[model samples]
Target: MLPDFRLTDRTVPSAIEVYGIQGNAQYVARKAEKQALYAREGAPCVEWIPPDDLASVQLPPAA
Candidate 1:
């Protein structure tokens, strides 16, 4: 079964923001599939870290 999904478009100066909602939906779908597979194998699913923690990670410069 697929999870419920929604999308909203917004005008923004950045290309990233324009595409952010679609990107987020893709991420959720991927994570949900991983979680479902883990559940089927009787393995613990990893919890997502809070956004603040994610934001604090130092990412390499974008190519």
Candidate 2:
């Protein structure tokens, strides 16, 4: 499992920012086509947030 460095209870991200949204049909169509291709290939699309963006993701104190 990928760790959430935000120290959040969010199991999954509520939103993801996609690459482009210039309102151009061709661009949007190409992006969708690529997504479909990846899906058919059983590839997973993932997003990322730098660890530095979060407050803390340190190891917990030992008991």
Model 1 scores worst on lDDT over the 10 consecutive residues at 11-20
Best by lDDT: 2
Top of the candidates by TM-score: 2
How far is 47's C-alpha from truth in model 1 (Å)? 1.4
TM-score of each: 0.39, 0.41
Model 1 pairs whose backbones collide: none
Error (Å) of candidate 2 at residue 13 is: 19
Write candidate 2's Cα lDDT for 1-62 as tens digits.
12222222334322222433457799677667756765686544442324334443333223
Q: How close is candidate 2 to the true structure, as a TM-score?
A: 0.41
Per-residue lDDT over 1-63 for candidate 1, one digit per residue giving the tens place of the 0 to 100 score: 222321223231111111123347787777667567656865432242344354543322332
Q: Measured by TM-score, how close is model 1 to the native structure?
A: 0.39
RMSD of 2: 10.9
Error of 1 at 4 (Å): 25
